[model samples]
Target: MNQATRNVLCMTGIKKSFSGVPALWGVDFELRPGEIHALVGENGAGKSTLIKIMTGAYRRDSGVIEYDQKSVAFLNPTEAQAAGIVAVYQEIQLVDFRTVAENIFLGREPHRFGIIDRRVMNTRAADILERLGLQIDPRSVVGSLNIAHRQMVAIARAISFGARVLILDEPTSSLTETEVSVLFNVMRRLKSEGTSIVYVSHRFEELYAVCDRVTVLRDGRNIVTRSLSTLNRLELVCYMLGRQPEEVSKGVTAFREQSQNILDRPVLLQAEALKYKKRLDGVSIEMRHGEIVGLAGLLGSGRSETVRALFGAEPLESGTVKLEGSLLSLRDPHDAIAAGIAFLSEDRKADGIIPELSVRENLTLAALPNLTQWGIVSRKQQNELVERFMRRLDIKAASAEQKIHELSGGNQQKVLLARWLCKNTKLLLLDEPTRGIDVGAKREIQQLIAELAEQGLGVVMISSEVEELVEGSQRVIVLRDGQSIAELSGEQKNIKTILHAMAEGADRQEAVGK
Candidate 1:
């Protein structure tokens, strides 16, 4: 391929800002035809912003975008789609209640005599799926399909729009090994057909398996772009983290050296052989007072399921839970709460907050019964408690009456934490507590977690960020395929050790299956 003909898309000196805060600082990116280019970075490394600008979800402050040898600036996603740029996000965006065909041809379906043409739409959808080597029923309801199939449908929809540049963001996060294999096959087919793909994922193995080249971004700037053949995993991780291998090793050593003195503390919560259908398999966990235990695992590794079962959010098929050496029967979350357990879900927007409620209301939600008397709430008590936590947790709000939605992500999370604290819970369960927040907010939350642990509240934290898990928790339990594989403490509680345990767990499982 000639130099000019090989370049399918080129973006130069792209700059974007949100409320005077720079997200992308004069970054450059390019994609060659028929190659899968991986875009990778930490949560706030500006990958999302750059992708949005490329897909026309956001307008760039200043940049030059050349596509197919022609300079073009698309004002919206529709325009970008028309120009053959499309994206399929991690969260599948399709009408679950509708048929797969209807979802694929939505908004621009074939029509005859001013009426929708179902036959034509189904035929087209079936053809696209077949071309993609997906054997899904186009006439079937989208909701009836598994997560992998739903993802395939989304890809089919994007291809139907004539996408030349396809962006796949964390597409295999929730898929099984078999499903990921199928997706990889589809990606290989797309690449062979000369479709330039932009693949974004946190899984290093997946990227190495499928991508030809990768562009690493750090602190909103282009750090490096190199072919996978030339770049080692350690070098890529160092570039993304802005850390040297020696520095990372030293940090891990320091963390292990400064171990906390919580070994003498009595057990606060104990779960024995917790089982929940296919999600959890004989999971047992023990937490001591004034101790922070970290749960580490990839998606579908039973990390979240273990916590849900402990908090009684999901019915436990077997096993027993004990608090302070006494058997505790938890039929539901209310019982768990009554037994002094609080769970903060990973999805903060969906389960953590009531957007329309005031800050005071959300903060005092769980402790409402305690704040009430004679079937009437004591407004004075509620206000006093809310004010205390708001100040203590450093929740920023104009007033306690301010709507929870008006605050930033960090403040919203603080409100949720306050809600649980007001109940005087003995054990706290936090899942992805620092996700989707800025660096400053993440630090504040980490500090708060430390403070809570010091105050003798046992904490079970589940985080996808390996660094956070290593630094925040004295003990780390590694889970794999619905089973707890290894428990690391002190010297064993480092990133390298934890990752080795996870990989070994996967290898053992594969061997057993074979």
Candidate 2:
């Protein structure tokens, strides 16, 4: 491959459908040698779906994929790996119990006389970590490392596989600024070696900094693919959204109050100076009726951990939560739910849904006690609640009895939403509720959150989409290094101001520590 003029990978007219719903339609894309290409779109713009098709996770319905001028059909992930296609997905996929070296060499460990060679694997892992400028013990268990370190390990593993085409899906979602810089340096090094990298992220600043070309997708279709030098952030956002830059402002006013009896009510949920382990410092936030509180920050800023602390998933060492002027007991998830608080975890497959269960079963799993009388579940009540939420959340499935594993990612997310809705919650903590869903489903979920707030159910939302956070939140709380530094609300809440506060707070905190 020539750095000046060589196409490393190309896909034309790619089409994929699942259960009558199309995820990718007539998609065309290309990656150039020694170039960093960014694929941008809102949630469910077929970004992940397109990558999965290219990497052999899903077979395209009709399309042609050419790598190195050779058309190929990858049968599985292993086949794609053999073809030098590697991906580090947004969601963590590494085994937690394994050490970093073991994870790097998994399924392909060097052997001596048919015996696994741990020493060689450890040496190679150490060398790779050093090349990446990461300081960590290769023998250390991945479970013990923070999310940021785990992400780096994933990247290292991919690079060690001798991947020629690297697909990084939201790679920096959980990284600090320093770690992100380190990753960028690694990407440049790979590019220098004639590797073609595909970068997918929602952060416009990052896209501008690292990508050489940009491709935008909307509603499962490719919108544009152009040189990064040809477009600004505003133009790129507009293209990804299928709207003009000026037209984007019109949608902001559509978020009107949709329900009643929400404004005059007292605080439904409140967290005061909450601290949790190493992830969260002193964080304080509150939720009021008819209002959604958004948590915004870079990855590792403790945004997700703050919600976990409030929901009792992460034990709070020092903090207090009050509901309606009385302190609430949150010893565990059960206690939190009993106190009228519901939490939707960020990891949907591991923490939110049970793969083997039916959609209705999963939805009613949490509130079974209430749906039962004298230790006997009332089937009628369970069905009623499930049907109600299914309609409310717009969960499209073959039936309520459909296996959750069989549905699309958007439908699965809707099922999880219904799980909390089945419980009569006064306060809801939603962590990336729109993640891994289609654009239509993402919009539906956002609208539902607004509607819930209007109905007097307080909401605490954590999202990667800054635009969503800015538009949906009545108050925005900025967290960094596990501490709440600023709150933007009422007349002061805007995207630019919230981002400025986060940056300023991080700088101040770092200076104070020095």
Candidate 3:
């Protein structure tokens, strides 16, 4: 057989650029029929670009794409789908108002002599679902089904198209462990039926469980392609991050070391056995007065969910939250706030600040009840409180009357901090407080957090940067799949330790294609 036709799909020297800036260069990728190949890469990598080019969503600047021994160029995704190459992105593409059968046979419905045949379409869709081991009803609304079933419906639609090559991007990102297990079973069934799949995921366990060969792309280039069993988690991470295992160092943030043994301080907040649907599974933590405890985890690792649970934002399955040794039952954010707990959300624009409001109004929004008397807000009280915090937090703005949206990211964050401080918040929950801000602003926030801790305020902070979490917090609590797996304090609080804890227990003996 010729080299180009050797695999079911092949690309050679694929290069794509935007305005003279190359996103992919000398990229060679191949897909063999009946094999599950894993495409792994970090953010800003060429993974999306390469996938788009291969799927005809974008035209390649220079490359040769051969599918099934025939060199073809598809102008759009519809053409690619017509040619038996289909992709199901992370965001499920389906009409909520449409039925499952309708979504499956949407553009290509069975017809009966100038009239659509619903019976035939339903039967065909049901057959495909049954074959894929899914029991969903054909007439069920797509929106009425859960994410796992919706995904299976998508796969069934692809199978209906006779898709020889299927690309699944982050298929298990929102799935539970049990749902993930079911998805892997379906994927194995597809592989046995001679369907090639491109599995893209960040979960190390899923790759070992379902995929055969792994390809790592970094810095707009293909780094390595190897058997999943050959490389460990650290090596794979190193390839994705373009770093040696020993090169993963710390001290990249502006936080200075703090005093240990703050454990003797009064326990401010104690949460145990926190469970919220699939996001939080038995997460527990203990925070002391004037102590900063960091929550470190990958995306969707329950870091944000844990803090939200503490804030009474998420409905819990079963848990106990104690503040100052008093068992507190919080039903909503109002309850949490009334209990003297303040929260600074990760998404400042959406959850924290009202962009249309003025700096003074936003700062005094949280303390409105105190500033209000007999259903009237005292402008004098609000203005005085705003001025005091503006001077204290160094919130630079043209004037307190200026809209918050006009201020820089750092100044907006300062105003938000002042909002919580004016309410006499006991335990401050900061989720990515310094995120989306400039370096100088981030340094200011970090310094302010340390100063707040010194003033005897208990803080629980969530940060994606391992160095920030490790250095800023007196202790770091690592979360994985909604579970509090490790709590590092003193000597154990470091980047390497947290990364190892996050990746531990994921490597299983189940070797792919052994």
Candidate whose TM-score is highest? 3
Residue ranges of candidate 3 with Cα displaced over 4 Å? 1-35, 39-80, 83-103, 130-150, 173-179, 192-194, 200-202, 213-227, 238-245, 248-251, 506-514
Please list the C-alpha lDDT of all candidates, in the order they appear.
Answer: 0.86, 0.81, 0.87
lDDT of 3 by residue, 451-474 (tens): 999889999999866777878999
Deviating ranges (above 4 Å) for candidate 2: 1-5, 89-161, 172-178, 202-206, 227-245, 248-265, 273-284, 289-310, 313-320, 329-331, 342-373, 377-425, 428-514
Local lDDT at 498 for model 3:
68
- lDDT at 34, model 2: 88
The clash count of every prediction, one per candidate, is: 0, 1, 0
Q: What tens-digit string does per-residue lDDT give for candidate 1 at 310-398?
A: 88899999999998888988889989999989999998889999999999999999989988899999999999998899999999999
Task: Provide the lDDT at 252 for model 1.
Answer: 32
Model 2 C-alpha RMSD vs. true structure (Å) is 7.1
**Candidate 3: C-alpha lDDT:** 0.87
